[model samples]
Target: MTAFMEPFRIKSVEPIAFPTAAERRAALEAAGYNLFKIDADQITIDLLTDSGTGAMSAAQWSALLSGDESYAGARSFRRFESVVRDLTGFAEVLPVHQGRAAERLVLSALLKPGQASVSNTHFDTTRAHVELAGGKAVDLPAPDGGNIDLVRLRASFATEDVACVVLTVTNNGLGGKPVLMENIRATRAICDEFGVPLTLDAARFAENAYLITELEPEFTGHSPRKVAELMFRSADIIWASLKKDGIANIGGLVALNDPDLAARCRLELIAYEGFPTYGGLAGRDLDALAQGLLEVTEPSYLRYRAESARWFGEALRAVGMPVVEPVGLHAVYIDAGELLPGRNLPANALLAELYLEGGIRASELGTLAFGRVDPAGGPDIPSARELVRFCLPRRVYTRSHLEYVVEAAAAVVKRAEAIPGYRIVHQDPVMRHFTARLAPML
Candidate 1:
């Protein structure tokens, strides 16, 4: 196989430091063995998350120089809004601090008490926001990664007051799989029948569009941008974090054609985030976002991004690691429970094992992230899979780095059988993965 090369050249570098096993052990203990709590300085190969971790390109940095800092009508905001409009074909764009902020704003406008907001799967924050606002975030089961259970979607609309039907284009919570365009069209048709609005949690829409261009024969010859424009037609509103496929460090926006809905969202955006123009972001952020919007869907860049992810996932699988079958666009999820047998062994143990083996830090996605804890904070509901996720940041890390990660995985495999289960000592009811404290069960 030809080596997957990054399409861009590096302009600068940051030195990484490795910690000794003894030091890592101490760090893990200090962090309550929760990998999320471990300091980045001690992590040799930090793969905890892809959010805001990607290195900015030289052009993005250059665009920052021309940023207009005016509070009300920055030229940077105009460029950002215009670029987003051209790509999404939505008439209105309201910027926000990040994707969840956009989600919150849209939900605030669309949802009422006892209303239901449905999706393929709600990522951590989306669910929290929905529940916090006195609404339910209902996740419909999908048999195949691309196909949603239409029966479930219709059932959600039928049983309760359906506020909006949400489709996460590259479903984030469940292995980053792309939703098929046909399913999306079908969803829109269902929403139309129910008189409910259809929105997109489109953080990875560009990546999903690229997958459609590559996999679907109906769109065989389309570019990612064109595919994205076509896909946006299926949703009444689109929300995305600029951090993901946007290739920016921070920023998010909601795009919609509905005048009343857009006005409602903008009012909420100003009350919570900021002015519609900058939206709690600096003018430089808008400039970078404008540049990122243009660069993200370039056909060459999309192909390289997809191929590079496949290269990483395939490389690990080659070493006998049990990864999620069809590789996700941004991350590789290792089946930790399968990696280490015995129902007694827990998924959270993989974090400490991988860190100790090679100073590699990966996020625990299975039980530690999704498991529900009771009133006393012990695990009440166990999650289905035990997954350890390594999310690749865009325009960062190369084949060489991935090879090191594979070596880390190999090292974890050596002592996998010895790894033990864990119990959560303390956790928040919502989005507990980030702040949950766990201790290895003896």
Candidate 2:
């Protein structure tokens, strides 16, 4: 393979502050050993998440100046809507402040008490919104749900009282794996059979499309944009996090062919967010998002976006770090269970040590994020996977940053056998990993 180069140059630079281990240790202790609680300034290489932490392109910045803020009739809104319509082919477009807000609006409009919703796997916010709307959210991952037969599973749901169905492209909480177009078409067919609407949490649509283009050999001739159009064909509605593959810092949108549902969400937007045009954001944000939708689908941009992630994941694996196979687009999931099977430690040991060793902050993407516990109140349910996620923000880090993380993993691996686990002393009932307090266990 030819040596990879970033598609763009760093026209500007922001100096990052590097904190000493002592500072990081105190910060971790004060923050209850939760990486989420660590302040931005304390983190040396912030891999905690890829959301809204990316660097924007010069074009995006230029679009910001072109923003025309006029309450309801903004030129920025027109451009944003036009871009979304062209990509999604959705007749109705309603802009929201972020992805979760789009999910909330859709769920609020479509779901009701005692209804059922299904996904391959629902992320925290998506599931919360479903339950908040009085629906029971169910996950039926192809293997995890006790059967590899998705047809049977779909049949089961169709026979029951199903309200809505959503498929998260590149399942976020589960190592950012992209869902195949075959699976998407199958899900859409099932939703159609039951007269249910199928929508997508398409936060990483462009990256997902790139994977489809690269890995699915039959699609070899298709560009990423064409692949996206193919994928969008199966959905009734599509909602996306502009923070992800949209190539922007912050924003999201809900677009669909159904005018009535779009009108209803617009009403919800007026009540909860702002006018349908702004959606609780400045017009400049819309301009950036519009430009992002266009840029993200460019073949060059998508190629670099994908190549960078594979490089990061491969670097870690090269040092014997057991990263998730076929590394996904946005992050690499270190298989902590495989790395330290003899140590009897949770993924946190790897997480904390990564910080203590190199000030590189990752996340516990497995049992911790999902709030799993053993049957008899022991350590988190020792499933087949225990992942420590290192997210790569788009265009934010250089190749050297990934090298630094690999070195940290190398140091952590050399001492993996002797490292002790940690016990969670305090946790919230929901999404506990974010605020949970931990103490060392030797």
Candidate 3:
């Protein structure tokens, strides 16, 4: 079957609301320890996620949804084009449905058999598209900071049949760590030498930009807007997920400096989505996305998200669990390897435990980490492993929700320790799970 026609089996888990605050409180107390979960009460503090609900001004909202023909058709391309020019100053733009869709277009347009695209790390969907297009997905060695190792990446481009190099602004796979500015400049130099195009996966670009100015003291006084302009300098093509960075609905766009490349990508888009005018975005969502892009630059918007993440991180550490050393933009991770001692509980099991305990949703990074590869003359397919991810989507949550997560997580961890030897059963390598068999961990 073709890549798009592949069927995925669904595993549905029902969500149930906890009876009361007190009942949730009892669950944590019964667990005997409170370490490892986020404090719910602080989740919503400075919430500025693009999830449709962030506070946008009436004018901003109106500008987005006005559906007037001037802002809707071929003119709509200019709506996105103007936004890209105003925000990052890129020369050309093509709107798409969301980030991954942009990935599919870029990879399909540029990659060929025996070719490869390298990154420090990649979002799962991005890797899938590269491999699906008959190319290799190469990653730079992990840096000490869990960011990409630029030196190794520089070397990869020198030798490999590299079609393009993608650099995600904040390494989402690695706790949302921001890529250092120095690395961006170095990678750009390497790409310029090899005649390779550099594409940016900027799904969390705003958050990464916010971190550069706020968290990095050396970058103090630098604005997120400035940071975006600086980073885009290295990229020939920029792909952003409007849902994550813009007004939190579903839309994406690819901005490029080369007119020919942008035109080529647009041709492929027509078959999968629609015309250049409405590439899968509703009239209202396009408006929201434009407003959300502007909101990301606001100081108050950045403050709220950063503060909430910081507060959640602090509470997790106080309880004795290993949280990602420093918090990044949206989601957080609990090091399951550290949480369950001697049990060898894979991250997949921890994710399942979290789900069964309270209908809380999370990802099993290990099992879900997929990428395709071609060995000499064969087809590309996904790889497998086991790790868990807790994605804290912005705006939809409040502080109380975070506290509930932390408290409920603590209770589950306590219950896990009592099982003599609980382990994850590898039913499918692509998606692992916990079996009924339970024993004490030695």
lDDT of each: 0.84, 0.82, 0.64
Window of ten residues with lowest summed lDDT in model 1: 340-349
Candidate 3 global CA lDDT score: 0.64
TM-score per model over all chains = 0.96, 0.94, 0.79
- For model 1, residues 1-442, the per-residue Cα lDDT tens digits are 5765678888899888788989999999999888888888998888888777888888999999999999998999999988988898899999998999998888878889999998888777888888888998888859764456798998876688889888887877777788888888899899999898888888888899998887789999888898899888778998988888778889999999999988988888888888889998999999998898888888878888888888888888887788886886788888888887664325678777888888888888776666655658554776766787889888888788889989988877777677787777887777887888888877
Off by over 4 Å in 1: 1-3, 341-345, 374-379
Count of backbone clashes, every candidate in sequence: 0, 0, 26
Q: After superposition, how far is residue 398 of candidate 2 from its true place, in Å?
A: 1.0
Each prediction's RMSD to truth:
1.8, 2.5, 10.0
| Candidate order by decreasing TM-score | 1, 2, 3
Q: Order candidates by lDDT, high to low.
A: 1, 2, 3
Cα lDDT tens digits, model 3, 108-221, are 989999798999777677777887898888877365443567778777865789999888877776666787676777788888988888888888887888887865676789
Question: How does model 3 score by TM-score?
Answer: 0.79
Better of 2 and 3 by TM-score: 2
Error of 3 at 83 (Å): 1.3
Q: Write down the lDDT that model 2 would get.
A: 0.82
- Identify the candidate with maximal lDDT: 1
